[model samples]
Target: MIFFYTARAKFNNENGADILAWTNYIEWSKLTQLTELVSIDTSINEVLVETDRTSEEDWKEIVIDGYHETGFYRTLDHVLKKKILKDLIS
Candidate 1:
């Protein structure tokens, strides 16, 4: 199944460059925190993702196992993105 996620950074009155720089600096390892934040299954296949990056918005494709069997979509959204960013920064 195909899943979409919007990645965002929390910057205080920062310009586009700052935000984009912050996002680019984000590590992929930090993103794995979603497995617990969203309660994702570890048995899922290797994730296939497509990222559309821009200064303002960053959209990503996430492939998770059991996306169809479970209501996984319920946990994947803007909130999840915010949490990921938070986890990345903190």
Candidate 2:
């Protein structure tokens, strides 16, 4: 499966800090691909994933878990590059 994702930072008034939030748009041709990618690329201790199977769109929503926003972004960049290269070669 191929997935597309975007992330952003939002300010938390109560905490007076910025939090990392990511929204993953997944192409569900293969269900396990995202899991595999996340497992291999990240070492985040607790991961939470929620899927919206009821939507009638081609892309489904997936939320990835990570406390370190910058680290997650770096991992995402690396994974995307690897996927692109694999796609191009094959």
If scored against the real structure, what TM-score would every candidate get? Answer: 0.18, 0.20
Q: For residues 44-89, write the lDDT of model 1, one tens digit per residue.
A: 2222222324523332233245543231222356446655566677
lDDT of 2 by residue, 1-90 (tens): 644443322222223332231212233333433432333233322222212246332122233355323223223554454445555777
RMSD of each: 15.4, 17.5
Candidate 2 differs from the real structure by a C-alpha RMSD in angstroms, to one decimal, of 17.5
Model 1: ten consecutive residues of lowest lDDT: 41-50
Q: Pick by lDDT: which candidate is best?
A: 1
lDDT of the candidates, in the order given: 0.36, 0.33
Off by over 4 Å in 2: 1-74
